[model samples]
Target: MKKTRFHNKYKLIILGVIILLTGCFGLIYFFYRQSPARGEESGDMVAGVSAGALSNTSFIKTYHLRDTTHGYGLFPTKDGGYLVTGDTIAGGGMAAPYPYIVKTDAKGGKVWSRDFSSQSGALGYLSNRHLGRLAVETSDGSFVTASDVIDFVDENLKEIYGDVLLTKLNKNGAQLWSLMLGDHNIDRPRQIWALPNGEVMLLARFLKTGYSSEITDGIPEYSVFIKIDKNGKVQFSKKMEWNATGAERLVDGGFIVLANIAVILPKPAENIVGPEVVPHPLPTMIKLDSDLNIVWAKSMEMIPTEMNSPTSYAGGVMTVGKTIIREAGGDFRVIQAAPDGGFVAFGYDNLILTQGMSSGGAINISDKDVSLRPLVAVKVGANGNYQWAKKLTVNLVSGGSANDFHVVRTADGNFVIMKDVAHDALGVLAAASAVNIGLIKTDADLNPLWVKQYSVERSVEGYGLWPTVDKGVVVAGSMQTTKMHYVMGTSEPYTEAALIKVDVNGDVGGCAAVTTHTGATLEDQSSYLVMQDMKVMGSENLTLKINKKVKEKVNNAKSAARDICKYKKSNVTPIYSLLTSSDGSSPTASGQTVVPSTAKTWAVINYENAKEVAVVGEKNQVIHAELLPILNQVYNSQVKMKDSMASMWLAYVFPRPVTRADVEVIQKNLEGLGYKITGSEGGDLWVSKIGLTLHLEFAIQNSMMGKLEVRF
Candidate 1:
């Protein structure tokens, strides 16, 4: 009987080995078929259509782990599998969310899922009450996780901030031990890097308990480096003054830290106004030795000679414009260590004001819209000197925020960037424009090759991206499921952890992770104007007529332009005590504070239209002053006509699809406004206003912008 049992065990062992070998071979063959040949040019897309890059790549499979699971980190294991760690909010009699770990096969099928929520029996001691921020596989096949847990009350009866917890688990997902490292305040890790020497390094922020002292009044946070051994034992902790946002390991065993510094500049003395304060933002780069000691630091400066080059060191500071550079926003958020020992970083550049507008010397005029901010890429040399920069312009209707948070490099020396974007073109309001994942494939030189987007019915934000051995990509993020309807009682939260796997060409194999269609359609541009047209029109023209006595002071009508424009030219006389707006708001105060009357040589025109008034001061103030009122009348007349006509056109064309009922309403409104309903074509309605033929293409989608065209 003993010999028979032993023989059966041997047969089972041999059968298991055969099954493993066959699975490995299948994976190898599958990957071989998916990958492109070496030296092949990457696929390109023109006008929202891909050439061949995505044609072959299709979604093979997708795995939804749980109801509420956030996958933050993914790693390929040695056995053609993957390990992912995040947090899960489970449903039970007493529900408590905790960090979770999952193992999957090469085909994205779940092998095992583990929730590390076990706690100690001691009172007030909470275990596994944290979310895993990062994880990596160790040499011995075990995993090390860096998670953060918040403690509302400590053992000492004081409020303790969140602490970083390090846990070690075996290959089967069983916990070996856990170590929590934090005291007095918050110690949050921004990034974790597994060193080649079997050690882990964490770039963290150490927020001190109290505010800054008198000497360092402006600095409040500290950037820190915490190193630990494989056994979860602390090696050393080093800290610096600046607060770091992103970091990466360098080829020379050093590290590069990216941060922004605020430099306070002295106000100009000649203006003789109150003590003005100017804050200049300096995108700074700091190099640190392997031991966590600062090696050298470089900051942006405005040296007058080199400001011409946008990528030059001096170009970092805009010295010629306004006293403060608040309108345009830029921040370096993530950095990637280049193969050539250099570094590439991505962020955004927001231009708030147009060029011709005056912004300095007390009167600030800026555009309120910030949706035009473009994604920016900055490249630096090995020594941290600025080399070059590129701006990725997004011309979406009513622009939205597009930011690249993570990046990965391909085997062909190209790069794949991952971003989460929200824009007006995607939806109507901010709530409807829940962020979507955006991907951009670029060449080795950082030039964009193709762009793609992914989203579901709700918002999805991708936080981590990894390149697989098969040349495919894996992305992990959080997804929210919004409630379509609400009731008087019951609570429903809409947050889920999501993972998406795309082929080497970025196609989701027929899954719900739909490709985002962007770029504005014509209909999106015209909806709101039509709605306004349906409302009652109140004809009110409040114009400011300059006194006849002031016009007599000007030498000629042409000189009046100088008074409205060249207020500082010294030859123009000051004009004050003009009629303010009906609500008593000063016409000169266009969102900016009034320039002190003590600077009497400068006079502001109280006209309704700034664009129509040609500002001319000492050189031609006399003529400008005369033209200001006449130009205001002409501007007022045009605006009033457009407002009245907008309603008539909208009443005829809206609730569109050019239905028979809508056409009757439109024709009646047009006739009331003294316009002729000329013709129709394939359900499109056409009207004649004055000498212009207006074509109202109907069947408009409500969530889009308004659109209108003139038929020549």
Candidate 2:
């Protein structure tokens, strides 16, 4: 019996071993078969080629075209597809780019694609091209496209300038008629408005060098209007003394032109340039007759709010500067005729110029301030007088300069604006601009209802937007990607054409788009937590009065408050949330719990955090003498010094360790602040005997400030 039991046990062991080996082999085969499928799935999602139903994911649909393709404009077709226009750089970045257009179905499927390179030139022979701001679908279902032949000179070859290039294409993407309209001088159309009567009006600007005295001399830009019939033949042309930026036809058979006229300030008494007084650019509105005769021109005053004026510098960040006054003007970028017959002009305003170091190692102060470009709106009556103008005070995600590129009047009578923004509001990114695109919806009076921002890793520029047939919005822009090649020690930037369609409610398909609005939590509503009333404990934290709803939610909440605190100057971070009951009951300190970030209602932010190490003046310079005037003059810029402080920090952040070149600017500025360098180490330095030490350290390839201890 024992021998039989041992034999059975041995058979059982052998059977288990066989099953384990078979299972292992099966698992390996399964994973091997699925590898390719997983890789392809990731490629489809990033390539934006999935036939994901438009009705399914409505939040946002991103499309990535071929290498070095840019999308400049988008227009929705009657069949629920979209028509996009942009330039394509084939061959490589060094090759000339050609205008490319695509027609995509509602589901973002490519219906057809056409590249104008073939018509411009043969292969290997590159041809440079520029698409007009947009291509519109004409009343006859065809497309009307315009471009500026750039860098082209006249027969005499005096100067290179852009000439108007127009092309009409049929439904099948075949060119029907191509024409070049301009004199021997520069002529370019900035915008085009398609009329209901099958006619198109071109809002063009021309060089003033060859025109009459009225159109030339003091005026550098002349507003040129050309009306063309369906045959693309000019019916009439008119010119006037206006720096036309944008325009729209009125319902009364007339036109309202949005322009930026130079406000010529009288020459300062110190310098007598009587007739050559420089003009400051300001937003102006001009009403023209059907014959294109200027009836009345109205230039608006600065924003009435105290913060909008320079005198309010001590009160708010919206104020530019007390002494850095430039022209309080903005160029009308986008204009739309309101439903009530009035016209709305949207642009940047309250500009101030500052003096700074130029690349040529020379100090050049700009004629206009580079720090502030508050987007403003001016409402003009039917008769061309200003009704009301106000700043669109919607808090931006990244504080920076923003310009509106497109505006459309929604079916609900509100206005939608598409703008491009950069991250550095302080002009610290050198000359490179553009980071993201923002969409703002405002009422008829220009009050912001809500704002939405869309961004990728790199810069995204919003160029054009149109109302879709489904009452949604179709946006056209460009998305860029970068790749670094270590072998070549170089970086290559590749741009792709991007298109996004949002439903009528500002929702992307079925996904609700994230917006820069106060998401009031249930606790906030029950307790009436007004953000403005939040007590500021210091620069980093704030105290909020917790009600019953907040108390109960805090005990069960996951993490602390993580939403943004929207302020007038900028939207800022809210680092932590410390909750306390109204009855003075404090919750037990426990482990940090994960909380829903979206449910956060409180935000704490500080706007005046200095980017540079603010230097201080000597005791004698502060006690009996004022330092602001001295610092302001020595800095030769907009520097506001208090009674005790004599310095402003530089904008560059210390990365890794500070280098000698980096510390040189700081040392020079400190010397300007009356600080004498008393000691120095490899990369560390000390000034005077005031106990100020700047310790520095170095890594493999970079340096950073190790410690900055200041005792004053």
Candidate 3:
């Protein structure tokens, strides 16, 4: 007796037929396609263990993300977070500069990272700046770093070009100030430090006039240490004829200076003997008084041995040394410098150069810049006597590829270092044989108090350092599931984000590292190492389900073409109404039934129906939804029974849990041509209405729109 909308638009019998078909399709789909989609991600683990390395040097935990940026100018913060500066891979000019900064929690997990130089490549804008050394903390709790800018312009702002870009960031990663260093290629900063008198000093290299062209410095390079007030006013500045690599403020408020001298050996002497002539690294050191006057200067002797690049700083000197590194098993020197001059001190073992076939230049000499070398830490006593010496190996040597550490003395009078390790190698190799960082805490005596190592899953090495904090050691990494079962194949390789927390004991622990955004389709290799977290942002099951439905739709058409092809006039187009997994676990679900939205599909045999194309297609979809309750036999469910497609439509719905057994059965059933099945519900299946001239699918989402189309 109820006057339905279909009643007003069609004859009573046809309207009844429409409602009945809708009910039948709905029932058919309910029992077939439709299952919940959800699961957890796993990790791959290798053999081995070392409790207190740097990071996961331990073999237990396998956590790590593949797409995180390696932190440059790494520093740990007070609140247990890290503040790093680097450029996004997308904007990075390879060796060129494109400035950006990232802030991560104490655990090396990113809170957020932003690129200030996204426009570095826009129009005429060709370059930006990369961060150098970090200076002292400001009165307001923020800190500053020195760097150089190039062809930079801030729209609506006045300044541009090679200015010294001084930036101050808060504990929460907010930018508070940006001070430019130069107007053009004339000036640039090499190092920076904080003064107790509310002033900041920068140690930088400057070029005389006319050096602005791509590569020429008229009067060679002079190093300048500049002092500026909190307001950016230049209070005093000094220039050293030679180039300085860095500058730092000593504990006593004085400054430490790092300089570089090109040790030219007059290659002609070497060329006399062979085709190749080897070059070497020189030693450079300078001591500047408060007024930026050069108090003392010195140069290190040519080590004549392997010299690794290890950066060092003290009251009036900055040093860099080398050690046995990477695959190159050779002892390197420990170079140092001070106010009076430089010391080409020797450390590590010693390099042994075996005679090789004659090749000239670049080959014989061992130096810092060319190899993966050992890292050295140096501290000079007030009286100039060396106070202490230390060298880290094992995890520090080969592991340097993955785990780098930051050494700092904590307020508690204890010293702690942070490192990273790769833990998942599937026993193919020992975790230690790969990469891992370790945090070794020692007493003021430098005696090992406790050691904790953290390891991650991926990265032949492991997750790069995030940041370090107080309390325990904070770190972050990522992980993923290995290959799918033996033969079923894999839909995708998924990954998740993780943050690791360690107690003083270095026991297995946890923290907050939400892995909400983690998947990305690899469309372009150029964009492989993305700076942002991965782009996988949807349900994993949804992907397979949509694909499954499409396959089902395809399966049905092929079957119809084959089944009735003998009928000659029988159209071979497939019709889709229900969904089923080829493996049968059609109605996939855990708790709530996660299923695809309901809809219908059909092919137009004639274009006339094409005008009604949109409408005609929708009717079948509604019928499919309507029949869900009926074919599944839910009487109380809202559905009108219709035998309209009874002639060609055969309904099948998965009622219970659609398991592996079900998948096998369904694959066999749909083996012939023209059989289309959809698991509207994960793990569930539903057959399509018969005789569709075109193949299509039913897709529904957050909105109320339903149409015959491919499942996305």
The global Cα lDDT (0 to 1) of model 3 is 0.34
Query: 676 in model 1: Cα distance from truth in Å?
Result: 63
> Candidate 3 on 37-120: residue-level lDDT in tens?
121222122222233223221112222212222323444555655555432232221233334445554334456544443133
The global C-alpha lDDT for each of the candidates, from Candidate 1 onward, is: 0.45, 0.45, 0.34
Q: Judged by TM-score relative to the true structure, which candidate is superior, 1 or 3? A: 1
Each prediction's TM-score versus the true structure: 0.55, 0.53, 0.40
Where in model 2 is the C-alpha error above 4 Å? 1-66, 117-131, 151-159, 196-198, 209-218, 263-278, 303-332, 351-373, 397-404, 422-434, 469-471, 481-493, 510-515, 519-712
Encode model 2's per-residue lDDT on 550-614: one tens digit a residue: 00000110111111111111122211122222223332222222121221111100001112333
Ranked by lDDT, the better of candidates 2 and 3 is 2
lDDT of 3 at 121: 39
Q: After superposition, how far is residue 289 of candidate 1 from its true place, in Å?
A: 2.8
Local error of candidate 1 at residue 529 (angstroms): 39
Name the candidate, 1 or 2, with the larger lDDT value: 2
What digit string (tens of lDDT, one per residue) describes model 1 on residues 103-170?
66655556666654323211111332222367777766777776655532243322345555566667
Native-to-model Cα distance after best TM-score fit, residue 533 in candidate 3, in Å: 50
Instruction: Give me the overall lDDT of model 2.
Output: 0.45
